[model samples]
Target chain A: MKTLVLVEHGDGKVHDATLATVTAAGKLGSVAALVCGDGEEAAKAAAAAATVAGVDKVLLASGPAYAQMLAENVAALIVPLMDDYDALLCNASSNGKNVAPRVAALLDVMQLSDIISVEGDKTFTRPIYAGNAIATVESSDPKLVITVRGTAFAKAASEGGSAGVENVSGPGDQGLSSFGGCESVKSDRPELTSAKVIVSGGRALKDAETFKEVILPLADKLGAGVGASRAAVDAGYVPNDYQVGQTGKIVAPQVYIAVGISGAIQHLAGMKDSKTIIAINKDEDAPIFQVADIGLVGDLFKIVPELTGKL
Target chain B: MKILVAVKRVIDYNVKPRVKADGTGVDLANVKMSMNPFDEIAVEEAIRLREKGKAAEIVAVSIGPAKAQETLRTALAMGADRAILVETEDEVEPLAVAKILKAIADEEQPGLVLLGKQAISDDSNQTGQMLAALMGRPQGTFANAVEVEGDSVTVKREVDGGLETVKLTLPAVVTTDLRLNEPRYASLPNIMKAKSKPLSAKTPADYGVDTAPRLKTLKVSEPPVRQAGVKVADVDELVAKIKALGIA
Candidate 1:
């Protein structure tokens, strides 16, 4: 059976995570990387470039609506191709998560999401309770759609082979959902999951008023995305979107810096994947130190300012 | 416009969940059960729709045991007009739950359906989109804000980099995100009145939807334990250690 891997891209470039999903799909069978976008030329180029091992073909579905990623439009485009493949895979990205379920529902199949490891066609492992626990779930259902966690799999080999590209389009009403303009907070730092460095703050910052002063400057210096512990968000020190924990987003930056945060199990689960962890907390025995490669015992109020000044 | 909000009864978000020893699932023998936090956002949005004169009626449904009525009542206390409890003792997978919801949608003919992006327990985050597909309606998943204007609904989705706004026709499914709204707590008076709210209980068989499991939990294991590390004496020591590690 051939696996259909949905390759997502933006601004004429494919996301690197798609390569990771391609690697995971390799375990199943021959792979077909599908790039659906507005410009056939761009899509075809991306498909040709995705030289995943054992890839049979690169399918490109190009249209004006595909220019900007809309879950409904994307789902409509991919649903028709579901019949051509046995298993569907995509990176567990925000876009992938949004569209994969709709596609699964259309085919009346089961979808496994945020999967970390796939042992076989029916068996997979994923994190639960945020990242505090791991569960292995087996799907007995025949049809399957999966969103592979980007960090879970290594990047697939992009050299040594290429696939023929095909341009395909089908009937679509394009009336699934409305497309509203996107408001993005532009940052120079890498995406949280793929970033080599991450700077996180906790309730020790006192409030959001001082976050810009403490975390942002240091994060900017380090070129890292800003993260928050649940305690910080619960205390209204920062927005919930920034919270990192078992209930929040999980990340594995190369370097993770936790400032003024007592590491809770939930928080630790989210960041433990980082290659090197550094924590700054007043409490010497804070749970964060357990996982931290470097632990500083001092008031964040003092340490952060000093660190930022040095940076 | 009639609107339905799907709720799930789960362990309180504040509770540090523990997996059962047998790895069947989360241990819930003594843990206090409450409505999922994101579902609370859905409940609040539905109530706002009703208060704004957008929804003619609002019905909140939960799929779980009879005890889930408590969560439904919480929704009622928050302003849902009625409640439905689809009694299922076992944990219903997202797709199956969506199937049950689609059945209810066919019966209710609601113009809009709202639910949390995912139940905290399973973290599937699939039901809203699945239900939308099953019902042949448009879906706006992970919506941070929804504004209904005449026959069209404007939804603000929480994308990875930022927010994206989309407009969809009526009779769509929308899922709530963290910033959707601050869910208001049920007042004492409303809590008292919620006990009087109309609650209808039915079996999945009644709706001709199978609540059977599609996914099996082969094992549940605790996350690896983090070992304790010593605190460096000062910033200079920390810098020295970090320099020694060659990370920064």
Candidate 2:
């Protein structure tokens, strides 16, 4: 089996999500990574991808067109490269979800999205109905297009392989789309998908100020990524980036501590995959307890600070 | 400019789906149904655009069983000028649905196509992008905000890291995200008027698109349950439990 994994990167480095996809691809067959970017940063990303454990080869496509990582331009670049590979895989991040379907359509095939397990070379397991059900789906098409749920797979080593890098051409600046700009929250906290531990809050935090004063200190003490329930985000306590639910980011950290969260099923869909779950809520009967491994029923205001101080 | 919006019928988001005992699929018998939430956002965006005079006509389209007409009526009550239903009982996967939408777009000649980033049921998140590919047009997915002007549209999209903005030329495909706007309620008067508005029924065969499932489902089961651990008395015990998990 031949697998081509899309390399997701930022800040001149390969995101750990790529390592997870690379690991998933290794299960399928010989692994090759494709890094699409522009100029120097693209080279940096390619070099980083070349070192992912078990990545046998890295293909680099650099130009102004790829700088924005627009789906239109990126899909254009990948559709032409599908002639050689049996399967194309990428992390189910925003970029992957944005581009892979278009590639599948242009290739006249169907895509098996967000697969969690490899049932076989042609069959995979995925979540449906906001992750309420798991479906084992098999693709009959000649080529398989899949987006791996990074949280479901363990990441490969970041710096162990010595794959050779190959330069490829990019279809320069397709006038169909253009990158206007991007605004990512500048933070020292780890990215949500790859973080080892996460401290997430819910609407029970009440408002923005209370959320910051209560959740961040606890998160910082543990050096964990910060997440929030959809209620918190919808209530304007945090930006969309912080929301963890079916509609937002899905994280499977080693320890997920949910604060003041009622544990709506939608919120559980995002983090129930975490290995160990801890809940902090004033109400003992909150639905979050159904899935939480450890329950702490009390006021978060008093409990969080005490936990942060004790830690 | 004309706006074309695609909506879908899915289980109400509030319902906890029960997997069938036979493991064929989730049980959908006698469950409450509603329009996919993100598609409601799409229809809302289209109505706001028409209200702003950026669009002259709004057409809602859906591809599903006869029950989908109720979803189309919901769109009509939300201010769509008309709706078209591509009726089919056979499973219409994303690729086939995109083909049918492409045919509809071709016939309607709308300047814009709007779809929910994904349906709550299958959650494939593929139809809009596939339609864009088949139509050879630009696409903006997971859009939080959108602005239209002469010959171009600017969309601010929600991504993994944060928000990113992209500019697409007119006659483009855009998918709605949750934060786009709160969908307005269908007023009692609007519901009455929606019955008078034009609604057309067609089939996938009429558009020469095959509504066949390309992927086979081998099994469907409930997600593995995470058993609840013992509750702790205080922060000290909580920290001890976390530490016992071998997490630093």
Candidate 3:
């Protein structure tokens, strides 16, 4: 079977999640990477993607319309390539979630999303009910389209044998949608998903001011990425990107610190896989403590400053 | 312009779902069911558009068992002019659900189709996009903000690092995210009015769409549990433990 993996990238560099998707694709069959973007940057990304350990070749499809990764245009680009491959795989990232279903629908196939384990070329295991249950699913669709969770697979190494790059023509504009610019949260701290250490806050921080004042110092002291529970994000204490829960990004960092978070099940589903969990809350019986490796019962306003000072 | 909002009934987000012993699926014997939160946001957006005089009618649709009408009633009470329940007892995958919605859209011919980005139950964030593909219409998924104009709609979507905006022609599909307007509670008077509003029922067969599951769920099981560790009395002890572990 031939598998085509979509290489996700930004700022002219391939993302770590794409590497993880490459690893998942390797389990199925011979893997090729599809890098879509505009101009020299797209070629550069294709070069980076070709270095992934398992990729046999790189397909470069560059055009002005591919710049912002619009779903309609991207799906149109992938549809013609479907006949050459048996399965198409992508990281279950934001871009993947946006584009995979369109590709599946255009191909007239069912998509298996957020697969945690690939049992076979046609079977997989995924979480449902917000990770409360794992379901093993088997699909009989002739053409398979799937998105694999990055945390579930190891990142494929970039230092490897050179793979041939093939330049492909754009599928042309679908004329149905157009990209309107992007506003990204500028942060010098590590990215939340790939960060080894993460410091997350909850609604207890009260407002955005208190949240930043208390959380930033601890995160900076530890050189950790900042995260927020749903309550914190809902309260507008931080941007939605900082949210860590079932509905948000999932991470399995080496160390995860929860300050003032009550550990809603949805939030726990996102971070329970962390290697060492720490919870600091005034409430001793908070659900976060149940999953925490080291629990500190105290007021975060007092404990957080002290913790930052010590760090 | 008419607006079509897709709603789904799912297990309440607050309840912890349990895996059955037989590993078929989550045991929903006596669980509280409610409208999916994101769908509520979608419904609210549609209603706001109508209130702003951008839309003429609001039609809410749900695809599920007979009980899903309650979810439709909730949408009706929230301000939908009418409701359509595509009743089905069999398992409906996202693709089939999209196909069913496409058939409904073909008949309704709404200018805008709105839906939640994903249902909390299956977490399959595909229906809206799939429906868009089936109908060959533009889509704006994970929309945090939406602005409707004469011939097009601009949507600010919640993306990976931050926000990305997209512009789609009229008669597009939009899926709501969390940052959309907060849904309003149905007033007592609105609840009584909703009971009298028109509700129509149909089945997947009516659309000639086979509502069979293309994917077979072999088993369902609980995730691995994490055990609780020791409690530290103070920051000093916590720092010591972290130092010992060498993770930080």
Candidate 4:
């Protein structure tokens, strides 16, 4: 069975999660990386790097239609490619979450999302109930389209390898629906899924204004993505985009810092995979510390500044 | 334009769910159930669109056991014009549910289809996008806001970093996010009115859709229990302890 992995990129650089997906595809079958963008150099580089991991070749589809970072349009480009491959895989990032299902729907295939393990052709293991439970499911359909939880899988070896790069035309003129517009947020740190360090806030921070001043700078200083607990999001301290929980985004950063957050079960489901967890909460009994590698019992108001200054 | 919103009955979000001691599945025995939060948002958005004169009809649909009629009633009380209960006894995967919705969409011919981004129970986050795909139409997932004009719909979607707005042509699918709108409670009068609202029951067969499992569930296991926590006397002591562990 041949596997097709979708490569996501912005500006010109490929998303690290795509690299992770390539690594995962290696475990399944002969992998082919699909780079859809307007940059030839990046696509060539991506194809070359992916080939080293035993990928047969890299297919590039460059066009202005690929520029908007819209998943609906991207799915239109990918659905046609499904016929040539046995399985389709992508990183379970926001983009993948949006596009993968559409592809599955188009193919009339069943898909598994936020998947952690793939045992064979039909059986897969995934986290359900936010990370509180792991369920093993068997796909009844022959064609499987799945999104791999980026943090659960290991990145493929990129040492001294290159693959053949070929330009291919993806299906366009999907009579695509246009989006109203995009509101962009500036970030200096790496994307949330790729970040090595994460600084997460909880509702204890009082409000959004406080999170911006007290938590964001620390994440910036550490080059980490900012995360928010479910409570913080429910309290309106931050947008739901920043939520990390069973219902929100799952992350496994190298170092996860929980600030002023009382860890709830749903919140813990998303971040339990972090290599090292540091919990800073005034409540010593906060559930977050139960999973923390190191725990600090203190007011975030007093401790965050000290920690950021040190970082 | 007429819109159809699908909802699911799941374990209440506020309650901490526990796996059965027998390892059969989540301990649903005597558990409190509520409308999947996202679907509530979907229902709310549909009702708001109709109230604003953007939509002519707002129909709420649910697929589950007979008890799920309560969920549909809640939607009716909240403002749905009527309800469709696609009654089923067994658990249906998201794909199968989408197939059923596609059948309904074909018959009802709603210009717009809306659903909650993910149901809290399964957390699959698939139904809306999959339904859109099955219908061969454009889709917007994780939408925080939706506005309709003429034959096009503009959706504001929540992305990883921030938000993106997309304009989709009519006969599209859109999913709701937490911030889409604060769902209004069913007032006493509306609750009474919901009893009088038309709720039609249909079997999966009626929609020409099979409710059989497209995915087999092998097993469900509880998450590893969190270890107990330690208490420190003060902030200075906590800082000292954290630093000793090389975490702070």
Top of the candidates by lDDT: 3
Residue A52's C-alpha lDDT in candidate 2? 85
Clash count (model 1, backbone only): 4
Deviation in Å, model 1, residue A123 alpha carbon: 0.7
User: DockQ of each model against the real complex?
Assistant: 0.64, 0.84, 0.85, 0.59
| Alpha-carbon runs more than 4 Å astray in model 1 | A44-49, A52-55, A158-160, A207-209, A230-243, A246-248, A264-266, A284-286, A309-311
| B143: Cα error in model 3, Å | 0.9
Tens digit per residue, CA lDDT, model 1, B22-66: 877678888999999999999999999888999989999999988
**Model 3 vs. true fold: TM:** 0.99
Which pairs clash in the backbone of model 2?
A293-B229
Q: Give the per-residue lDDT of model 2 (tens digit) for A1-311.
A: 99999998876788877788888899999999999999899999999998888999999999988887888888889888888899999888889999999999999899998989998889999999989999999998999999999888888998899999999875666789888888887999987887889999999898999999999988888889999998898899988898888878989998999999998888998999998899999999999998888999998899999888888
Summed over model 4, clashes come to: 7
lDDT, model 3, position B71: 99
What value does the lDDT take at residue B111 in candidate 2?
A: 92
Candidate 4 residue spans exceeding 4 A from truth = A39-52, A234-236, A309-311, B229-248
The C-alpha stretches of model 2 lying farther than 4 A from their native spots are none
User: iRMS for all predictions?
Assistant: 2.1, 1.0, 0.9, 2.6
Predicted structure 1: lDDT = 0.82
Fnat, 2 decimals, each candidate: 0.67, 0.85, 0.83, 0.58
**Candidate 1 lDDT over residue span A1-311, tens digit each:** 67898887766555668878888888888888888767655664565545655567888777777766677787888888888788899877667878899899888787898899988878999887766568899988777799988777887766656788787885544776656688876666677767777889888788888877888888886677888887787677765557676546678877889998888766876788777888998888787887887788888878877776665
For candidate 3, the clash count comes to 0
Give candidate 4's root-mean-square deviation (CA, Å): 2.3
Q: What is the lDDT of residue B120 in candidate 4?
A: 78
Chain A alone, TM-score per model: 0.88, 0.97, 0.98, 0.89
